[model samples]
Target chain A: NAGVTQTPKFHILKIGQSMTLQCTQDMNHNYMYWYRQDPGMGLKLIYYSVGAGITDKGEVPNGYNVSRSTTEDFPLRLELAAPSQTSVYFCASSYGGASTDTQYFGPGTRLTVL
Target chain B: EDQVTQSPEALRLQEGESSSLNCSYTVSGLRGLFWYRQDPGKGPEFLFTLYSAGEEKEKERLKATLTKKESFLHITAPKPEDSATYLCAVQSPGGGSYIPTFGRGTSLIVHP
Candidate 1:
């Protein structure tokens, strides 16, 4: 059923370049999140959305923007990418924001900015 | 500030050996605790969620127990396939916030 899918599995961009990481879920979840994981590090929240048309910043949201124009898609845009932004990006979704609800994650998108 | 920390940044065990991973956290208010397993080049896969202290959950060879300040993931007789990075996260109880704060994961390697 393609639970959650992320596009451009791998990409390399130069400094000052821009790109968008695409994410889509078929579970009709109301909550979506974007996280970046550095090598040997944990996932850090970049941005999230409670529902379509509702977006909010999370920890380490700098230099990133997110849009939730549809129930199934939440894309993360990197504006003026920097070398520090080189990390693996993951997209996740949950049925609701309940404390017990588990999040389903997409494979991941590896981005490198040189 | 909310934060999570995991111990033994890396672990190596022989197949059929058992071990435990630690995840500690400090938050204003605890909403939930989550455990995930991440394979090379893949995203973290959900494993268990504990909402309160004294809660325990089990799946196959793994069992998770939560306390007020920490959680433990016990691996019983792990196999090579179980080698991966184990991550821990905590959700804050701040008003209407669901995003979780994650800790640097513990890397586990099982050798045959």
Candidate 2:
């Protein structure tokens, strides 16, 4: 199982620019999540999806949006990039929505907003 | 609010020197605690999960123990290859979100 995969390992965006981060999982997980990790900080949830066509905001979902069109794909969208959004982004998935389920993470995408 | 705090932000140890990393947390009705190891430029790999206080889990040279308020990851006779950033997280059963709150992580460097 390829586990989870993310695109554009590294990206640089200018102020006000918009982009979409793509994530796909082959494990057929029912839950998918997007998180950002800053230097000297823990991973903060940005958005999550419980299933296809069902999405919800996470802890830091102010400038981000997400869609789960298929069980294998969950994409995160940034409407307006800012310097504060520069960080490493990770996509994860789990078989279920319970706390006991283990999440499989992707390689991560490093974003630099100038 | 649920919070996780890890100590000794960074630690350097000689090969064969054992050490323990601490993760303290505060939450309402704890559901689970998790430990992960992350290498540079890669995503984190799950190590262990503890469900309740007094529970312990081990893999290879690493052992994780959980308590009512904290969790400890102990490395025994570590080698240089075992160096990585160790992260701890906690999940509560409240609010119906079931999201895990992670710690800043403890960076470990083993010198040969």
Candidate 3:
């Protein structure tokens, strides 16, 4: 049922450029998260939203911003993209905030900054 | 700081071979441990969840067990399609937060 979908399957940006990665979910989940995966490193949380209009910083939030304007969308923004920001980005969603709640993830968005 | 570590960064197995991947964690207050499978260029897919020590969960050829300090994902008679990265994550005791600390996944390659 198209659980989660991310746009721009791949992108290449020059240094100092700005871009936004789009993520949408059809499950009407209340919790959404943005994470980045680097080589040999685990997924690092970038930002999260508990619900529409509610957002919070996560473990790694530098050089990025997020907005949750609706129940079905959470977009991650990259301002002044840098080489360090080049990585595979993932968007995930869950029905609740409980520890037992399972998170469903999208395919992924690969971004490269030169 | 809450941390999660996985052993054997990469593993190569033949068809029908069985092996186990380890995930060790250190957190102030444990809530739940999660296992996920991720294929190359794709996001992680949920596999199992273990809430307490001595708890076990099984799905297909994968069996996940939890202890006080570590968790193991045992694959029995795995096939070529089982090749993927296995990730381990833990939810903290903090209320109203679903944030999970994740470990570098164990990349598994099963040859047919």
Most accurate candidate by TM-score: 2
By DockQ rank, best first, the candidates go 3, 1, 2
Tens digits of lDDT, candidate 1, A32-53: 9999988877888899999999
List the candidate 3 regions with Cα displacement exceeding 4 Å.
none
lDDT tens digits by residue: candidate 3, A1-114: 899999999999999999999999999999999999998898999999999999999989999999999999999999999999999999999986764678899999999999
lDDT of 2 at A77: 92
Q: Score each candidate by Cα lDDT.
A: 0.92, 0.91, 0.93
**CAPRI classification of candidate 1:** medium
Extract clashing residue pairs from model 2: none
Error of 2 at A79 (Å): 1.4
TM-score of chain B of each: 0.96, 0.98, 0.95
- TM-scores for all candidates: the values are 0.95, 0.96, 0.96
Task: Judge candidate 2 against the unseen true structure and give its global Cα lDDT, from 0 to 1.
Answer: 0.91
Interface RMSD of each: 1.5, 1.2, 1.2
Candidate number that wins on TM-score, 2 or 3: 2
Worst 10-residue lDDT window for candidate 1 chain B reads: B92-101
Question: For all candidates, what are the clash counts?
Answer: 0, 0, 0
By lDDT: ranked, best first:
3, 1, 2
Candidate 1 lDDT, B23-61, residue by residue in tens:
999988788899999999898899999988999999999
After superposing all C-alphas onto the true structure, candidate 2 shows an RMSD in angstroms of 1.1
On the 0 to 100 scale, the lDDT of residue B65 in model 2 is 96
DockQ of each: 0.73, 0.71, 0.77
